[model samples]
Target: MKFLYIFTRSAYGNSIAREALDMALASAAFDQEVSLVFAQEAIYQLVMQQNSANTEKKPHLGVINALPLYDIDDIYYLAEDSSTYNLPPAALVPQAKALSAEQFSSLMSSADRIQSF
Candidate 1:
């Protein structure tokens, strides 16, 4: 099955990011095809220089970085959002690829199941 996880929330001040990450990992562990999309503010989760110390929340970057090891390599972000958020390619995690708006819509249409947070 094609499992698409869409994240639209920021990493800090919420549990949604963690929840989606956990579900993605679980889906991959079960040998299902898993892909992740970081859209809107969720793209903030991929910013490299995050410090959860002040937020009093555990840094999710560790698990996010470890995704590839779990066979969850099909990660992506909304292409235009990078420019909108002023995040250059260097500012984000390396695993995620850029997907244009049209491509993103096609992706959504192709997925067998989708979960958004």
Candidate 2:
């Protein structure tokens, strides 16, 4: 089955983003076609310079960076959402793709199942 995960969770707050990543990874491990999209504030999670210095939160950057190793390489960020929040593509993690709203919608349509967090 093809699975698409859309995560709009705060980058720092709780474990929502982490849980999304974990679920995406698990889905891929089962040999399922999995994709992930970051929209709204969740786009901030891809910022290359995430400073967790002030908080005791474990920076999930390392985990986010490991998605390819887990075979969950269909990562994307919403352009409209990122622009609304003033986040630029340049600020994203290395090689992370930015998609237009239309492109994102098209990707969503191709998904057999979609779960948002």
Candidate 3:
């Protein structure tokens, strides 16, 4: 089944983001088709210059960058939110594609299972 994971939080200061990533990765390991969407504040997780220097949590980007290696490459972020947050396309991780509102809606419609965090 196709599994969609939606992330709507920052990368640090909490474990939610990492936990979600772990779950998404685990789903892929089990041979599930996984697609990850970073929305709202979660877009920050895709920014190239993530500085978790002051936070106790290890920088989560390392895990995100390794997603393609796990064969989980359907990564996306909302284009509207990205622009509103002033996140230039160049600043996002290479694996992340910008999805238009209609595309996002269609994606949600197509997923067999979706987990939001």
Candidate 4:
């Protein structure tokens, strides 16, 4: 089965972002096909130079970087949101692809199961 994780929250200030990553990793470990979509403020998770240690929050980039190691490389973010936030694709981690709204919808429609955070 294919699993799609749609993340729309900021990486900090809450546990949902980390919990979503955990679920994706666990699903991949079980040999399920998993894909991640970062939308809205969740795109903040892909930005570089995050210093969450000062806030006592766990940094999310490390877990994001490990996605490829677990064979979970299909990471995407919404281009509209990125532009709205003035975040260029170059400013984000290399593993993420920026997709248009139509493409994002197509990808979401292809998933067998969807989980939104």
In angstroms, the error of model 1 at 89 is: 1.1
Using Cα atoms with residue i matched to residue i, what is each candidate's TM-score against the true structure? 0.96, 0.93, 0.96, 0.97
lDDT of 4 at 81: 90
Query: What value does the lDDT take at residue 27 in candidate 2?
Result: 94
**lDDT, candidate 4, 11-40, per-residue tens:** 986789899889999999999999999999
**Which number leads on lDDT?**
3
Compared with the true structure, model 1 gives a TM-score of: 0.96
- Candidate 2 segments exceeding 4 Å error: none
- lDDT score at residue 104, model 4, on the 0-100 scale: 86
Error of 4 at 85 (Å): 0.7
Q: Residue-wise lDDT of candidate 1 within 6-82, one digit each (tens)?
A: 99998986887888789899999999999999999999999989999988888989988999999999889998999
lDDT of 2 by residue, 1-117 (tens): 999999998678868888878889999999999888988878888889888878888887887898899888888998787679887888888757888879988998999999999
What would you estimate as the lDDT of candidate 3?
0.93
**lDDT, each prediction:** 0.91, 0.86, 0.93, 0.92
Model 3 error, position 28 (Å): 0.4
Ranking by lDDT: 3, 4, 1, 2
Residues 1-117 of candidate 3: C-alpha lDDT, one tens digit per residue: 999999999898568989989999999999999999999999999999988878866888899999998899999999998889999889999899999999999999999999999
